[model samples]
Target: MRVVMFGYQTWGHRTLQALLDSEHDVVLVVTHPRSEHAYEKIWSDSVADLATEHGIPVLIRNRPDDDELLQHLKDADPDIIVANNWRTWIPPHIFNLPRHGTLNIHDSLLPKYAGFSPLIWALINNEPEVGVTAHLMDDELDAGDIVLQQAIPVSPTDTATDLFHRTVDLITPVTTGALALIAAGHTQFTRQDRTQATFFHKRSAEDIRINWDWPAHDLERLIRAQSHPYPAAYTFHKGNRLEILAATVSQNRYGGTPGRIFYRENDGIVIVTGHDARTGNNHGLALTRVRTHTGQELPATEYFTTMGGYLTRRP
Candidate 1:
């Protein structure tokens, strides 16, 4: 089958590589230009570079709405289009262009986590598993009919970075398998249950700010979700940003206001957590490691020499 791929970053890079290695011919490639956005900078293997190296026609577009790009797609005349991490909404005219239509590779199970930063959101929400889905594109964003879906169990100690690696490795096999099925004229794809669907926004600095009102267990998961290279989950202490690098739920319950620097537990500092913390029945959040705004990383034990202050959401 002749193919056109719309992809960006490492996800797109891997998808393109899969197409290049498959029995299909990747005739044209469309990808987004380099971005300075925080999340876009990570997992960024260049899709454009790989296409050029292989001598495939490449087009760079922030979106696929322009006439020149439309004309180019018509000229390439591909049997199908494969997209991964494309970063923008692809229109019907283009997605519906090919005979078999466009196949999108998303990094999470469909009907849930349908939007950006899916792995991070899933981990923070304590989902038991995480994986990729290959679906046929429709008018709605990521609301397509499922072609192939695969998942992996999310470990208790897994971080967003860990899940990224695990799920990414599945893209190749999923992409190839879906294409082979389509090439063989398989049309009985699964329809997504919109009632069970969820969508999330892209992560920003504001999203990582720690809210002590949350239970310690949830806070701990948030810390892991925003693991290294994706910015740390943070709070304010003494008018400075304190990024929590490692944390756990305390074994004992504590009393007083949420975010209070209460007592030392094991090898970490225990911060009172949960909106109902004043009841003294809620578990506290134990900060094992932290980073100061100045970039100095330290054990929470060394950093909070004397307790009894508050970790605020704002300075």
Candidate 2:
């Protein structure tokens, strides 16, 4: 089948690579233009690079509403259009261009983490299982008919980066399998249950700040969710920002104050919880790895010593 592929970021990159490896013919690839601003430095290779390497025509557009994009879509005349992590909401006309209709590969199971940063939100919210779904693209974001879905286990130690890689691995196989089924006309698509749907917003820097007052389990989830690749959950230590990369729930129940650095152990730093004795659980959180304001990543032991044990708070 002739295909028009739309994607961005690493997820998009993986999808494009899969299509190249598959039996289907990718006629054109569409990707967002590279952004080189102070806040957008995380941007990586353009999907066009892969398409160009494969000798396929490539189109770069910031938004799907562009008139040029509409013209390009008409010119491509693809049999199927597959969108993977395409940031923009595609216009209806583009979705209606192909005969088989456009298929979208969403990171989370449909009707769940629909909007953006699904993987991050899943870990932050302590979801036990994460999955990918291939669905028919609709006007509503990720509110489409499901073509295929597969689940992946999320370990207690898994970070957003870890889940991201796992999800990608899960998605590639399911996506390729779905495409092959579609090409063979052997699959039936089911509409999503709108009542079961939930969407998450794009995670911002403000969301990365660690809230010490939250329950130890919740804080632990957040720490793992944002660890490495994604920014680590941060807290203020002696007016300096400390990024907590890894942490474990402390088995000990000694607690006077939340966010209080009780003591430093060889394994990590044990901090007390600030919950009221009558109502809140007095569990401590152990800090394993942390990043200092100097942009240095160090173990909690090294960090506490380097700061001259300044994290202690007045009782």
Candidate 3:
């Protein structure tokens, strides 16, 4: 069966590679255009380069609803459209263009994390398991009928970067299996339950700001959730912004004012999360790795030489 692919970023690129390696005919690829800012993440190894290398037709457009793009989608005449990490809203007219309808790949189980950064949100919330779902695309956001779902257990040591690689790896096999089912005419759809659904907003600068007032475990989770490739969770110290790359719960427990350095080790510092509003207990996050404002990565002991002042939300 012919497939019109829509995707962007490493997630999409990996998915495209899987489709190319499979038996399906990929007719065209629709992806986002290049970015002006070099730091912008949306401009990763997009479908354009991969499509060019593979000799597949490519269209670069942010919005897929334009008249010309719609005509191109119509002309491609794809039996099905496979969308992964596609950034923009795809109108129903375009998704309905294919013969077998559109299949979308989401990073988490549907009816739970239905918006951006689902895997990160799941880990930050300390979900025991994360998952991948392949489903039929509809007019709404990620609220599609699931065709295939598989869960991966979340380990305490797993960082967002770790889960990201593991999660992207799931796409190749999940896509291959879903496309096989579609090709064999054995497609089965499970309608999503609306009551259990959660729609998270796009992660912003505020989300990355660490509140030491939060439980130590929660703060630790937040730091790991945004670690590396995404953006490190951070806080303000002595009128300077510092990025906390990683942290863990203190093994030797002691308590003080939240965000105040309570104990300093050769490798790290234990900062108190005095009492959580929800949990009603004292906890302290042991900062093991940090990055200074000068962009120098250092151990917490080196970074906190003068630490009477508390870490704050803003500098």
TM-score of each model, in listed order? 0.99, 0.90, 0.93
lDDT, candidate 2, 1-315, per-residue tens: 989999987778888888988888898899888765322334354687888988998888778888887788788889999998888788888997899889999999778889888888888788889999999887888987898999898887888878777888875788788888888896577889999888987787778787666777888888888766666778878888878888887776654556667766558787765455234356667788988889998888877764223232221
Q: For candidate 3, give the lDDT.
A: 0.84
User: Candidate 2 local accuracy as lDDT?
Assistant: 0.79
Task: List the pairs of residues colliding in candidate 3.
Answer: none
Q: Is candidate 1 or candidate 2 better by TM-score?
A: 1
lDDT of each: 0.96, 0.79, 0.84
TM-score of 2: 0.90
Runs of candidate 3 with Cα error greater than 4 angstroms are 36-43, 274-280
Task: Rank the candidate models, highest TM-score first.
Answer: 1, 3, 2
The 10-residue segment of model 3 with minimum total lDDT is 34-43
- What tens digits encode model 3's per-residue C-alpha lDDT throughout 211-268? 8878888888899888777778989888899999878887766656777876775467
Against the true structure, candidate 1 reaches a TM-score of 0.99
Least well predicted 10-residue stretch by lDDT in candidate 2 = 306-315
